[model samples]
Target: MLKNAALQYYHTVCSPNISSLLELRQSRKSNFEGREHQKYMLVKWNEISPNTILKKIESNDVELALSTLVINLRNIRMNLSPEFHAEKILYAKLLQACRTHPAWTIACSTINEEDTAALINSLRSNVATWKAQNKPTIEQFPRRDLDDSEILFIDPRYFNSNSN
Candidate 1:
């Protein structure tokens, strides 16, 4: 299971690089491009009260409430919101907590081998596609881009991004 809070931390998202000085070409069709966004609730499965969860997570006690949140998210993924990933600041805190104590994260309990593999496969393909279109040079992907060290692996972290 994945949490919305963690997704937000992914800040992995990149906005369009529209140049202010660039001239627009005349076209009958629209030039607009929409990016994807996942909306996560500020609260966690009704546990970890809004204002309080933030502080607790900062102290690393976030594992206390992360399970419920992750379960809810998994349900969302398996059922209703397959293409959406909800991310909130408070949710990020829970993610941090889960990182420190993975036994508490859904990845440890809810996520099975097949689901984990499927998710990984999807991510690899997505990364490949992104790499192809953007043509990320070796220098750009240097340690930083390829690095998973930044992510704390408590229960074996899982990141999900929803894009149309």
Candidate 2:
């Protein structure tokens, strides 16, 4: 019964919002495009909707299917743009709610730890590279009033030799 509620929350709320974000990201040029593993993850995430999970449940591999979905959802959340901060926070809360449910442990156990760690490392590396490449230049920062003047901006205390 508890599992059903979690699944319902995922199907009705989490999936649609996540899918829309993923679709929007897909339509644009993405960092994921440069890496084969990321591209594979993107494709897998797009393929495994809540409806697909429902079908998988009929095959008696529900635990593995749910585990994959959760992992994919985590990856999608990690890749979401900063513009979606509110949505990301909401998803994090929702994911927390799902995780609190007892059924989550059962689903989680079906996932391979080594693969999950590798996937996480790859995603982290991708994010780090993207941040490095797209970081704001010094010129992009807002200039302070002192920056516009040629006068030295040192503190007055630095000239007080008598204090020592």
Per-model TM-score on C-alpha atoms: 0.19, 0.25
* Number of colliding residue pairs in each model: 6, 0
Q: In lDDT terms, which candidate is top?
A: 2
Candidate 2 at residue 10, lDDT? 54
Best by TM-score: 2
The alpha-carbon deviation from the true structure for residue 81 of candidate 2, after best TM-score superposition, in angstroms, is 0.7
Taken over the whole model, the C-alpha lDDT of each candidate is 0.37, 0.48
Per-residue lDDT of 107-156 in model 2, one digit per residue for the tens? Answer: 33333443544433433344345456556776767776754566677787
| Stretches of candidate 2 exceeding 4 Å from the true structure | 1-49, 54-58, 83-164
Which parts of model 1 are misplaced by more than 4 Å? Answer: 1-64, 71-82, 85-97, 102-112, 116-164
